[model samples]
Target: MKIRMRTIGLIGYLTLLMLPIYWMLNMSLRENNDIMSRLAFYPHHPTINNYVQIFTDPSWYMGYVNSFAYVGINTVISLLVALPAAYAFSRYRFLGDKHLFFWLLTNRMAPAAVFLLPIFQLYSELGLIDTYLAVALAHTLFNVPLAVWILEGFMSGVPREIDETAFIDGYSLPRFFLTVFLPLIRAGVGVTAFFIFMFSWVELLFARTLTITEAKPIAAVMTRTVSASGLDWGLLAAAGILTIVPGALVIYFVRNYIAKGFALGRV
Candidate 1:
């Protein structure tokens, strides 16, 4: 009886989670006229025009390309910068180490809104506005701290004796970090990369404000659909559904690492 009840509860939970996504997909396949004039779970007139527009239109698809460019840059930069920082924190004691860690966390906790004006002025002066580098660098203010915190946890779990043994064997610091230490924490790196990518990918305020035409993110592009025609529900739904694809693909590739990384941080 208990097992049956648990099974039923699980099914109910899954349905609630999937229902909205299903509706979005359903609307993407539908015509705008049918959507507004009727109430139906399934589309009355299924069409592929919405998806076609996304692929064929330059303004539409370029947003996606621009988004991927910045997101990839941000993820790689965050991991590269954080790895060394995390290693330092985990392997040795430093002055005000705890305070430094807390300070990094506080940066992550602070509202992104607070940094907008300063970020704009700095980027404007440097002529970096509307460039991929601008958004990528701005996102680092948040992603680096998170990457360091998570990587530090995984790094702490590894025995310090390994570092000592590597030194005794005459292995250089860079060689040990790349060839030996990194593999031990590959799962944490995967998890951290996935998180950084998603944050840069979905975050709208920084991406929209920092870019004009040459580097506008897809999320910002979607907002432009609400013009004189009211709203292109079909096209809008299609774009939103497409936006979720990269994130889903990231999860699929890192499915194994995600569970392991989360588990290690517990204690």
Candidate 2:
């Protein structure tokens, strides 16, 4: 009886989770009339027109390109910077080390709105406003700290004797990290990359303020659907559905590493 009840609960939870996604898919494949006529559990007559429109439209596709370009760059930069910072925090003690670590994390706590004007001014002076670099750099300010905290925890779990052993085997610091330390932390890296991608991908305020036509992200473009004609429900729903694809693909690829990543520092 207990097992049966548990099975029923699991099924119920899955149903609740999938129901909304099913609704969105249903709405995307549906015509305007079907959406307006009644609450639809599924579309009566399915059509791929929305998806087709997305591919054919330059504005729509541009958003995808811009979003991916910046988010990808931000992820790489975050990982590169955070890996070393995390290692230092985990392995060494320096003057004011604790204060510096906390200071680094304070960047994450800052509201983006507080820095918008200063960031805008700084980028403008550097002639980087409205460029991919601008948004990528902006995202790094927040993402790098998170990457550091996560990687630091993971690095701490690694025994210090591993480093000492590598040195005794005539391995240099760089060689030891590349061959030994990195492999052990692969799961942490995967998880960090996933989070950086997600945050930078969904963030809109900075992306919108920092970029114009040449580098506008998808989240910004989604806002334009609501014009004088009222909300383009069909197009809006289609865009919203499409937005989930990249993130879903990323999570699918990294899902296997998530548990291991979380357990890194715990042990």
Candidate 3:
């Protein structure tokens, strides 16, 4: 009886969570006219035209390419910068270390709008506007601090004796960090990369502001679906569904690491 109740509860919870995604999928399969005309659980006249449009149209597909390009760049940049900083935070003690660590979190805490004007001006002067690098660099301001926080937690969990032992074996600092330290915190790295990717991928304000056609993200392109007539409901829904795919794949790959992170209290 207890097991049955738990099973039923789990099913109900999952249904609640997936309801919106299922609704979007349903909407994506119907024409915009069909969608706005009725409220239905399933599409009576199903179509794949929306997905077809997204694939066939350069403007639609390029938005995805640009988004992925910047997101990838941001994730790599954040991880590269954060790993060393996290190691320092985990292994070393310096004057005002706690204050400095807190300061990094404060950067993460600040709204994206706070940095928007300054970043836009700086990039404008550098002629980086409308480039993938612009949005990627802008996202780093937030992602790097978060990456450091997550990585530091995992790094601190590692024993100091590992560093001492590696040194005794004549391992150089960079070699030890790469060959030894990183593997020990692989789960953390996965978790951090997943977060950085998600944050950059979903962030619209900076990406939308920084890029025009050359580096426009899918989120920005979604805005184009709205026209004088009305919203292209089916296309909008399909784009949303496609937009979810990358994050879903990332989650699937890093699921084990995420589970471990939760177990280790580092998520």
* Alpha carbon deviation, residue 258, candidate 2 (Å): 2.2
lDDT of 2: 0.87
Across 136-192, the per-residue lDDT of candidate 1 in tens digits comes to 999999889988988888899899999999999999999999999999988778888
lDDT of 2 at 75: 93
lDDT, candidate 1, at 113? 96
Tens digits of lDDT, candidate 3, 1-267: 999999999999999999999999999999998998889999898999999999999989999999999999998889999999999999999999999999998988999998899999999999999999999999988889888888888999899999999999999999999999999988788888888898898889999999989999998889866653378999999999999998899889988777655443254
TM-score of each: 0.95, 0.93, 0.94
Candidate 3 C-alpha RMSD relative to the actual structure: 1.8
Q: Over the stretch 32-143, how does candidate 2's per-residue lDDT look in tens digits?
A: 6678888867777888888898889998889999999999999999999999889999999999999998998899899999999999999999999989999999999889
Best by TM-score: 1
Off by over 4 Å in 2: 259-267
Q: Cα deviation in Å at residue 43, candidate 2?
A: 0.7
Off by over 4 Å in 3: 227-229, 259-267
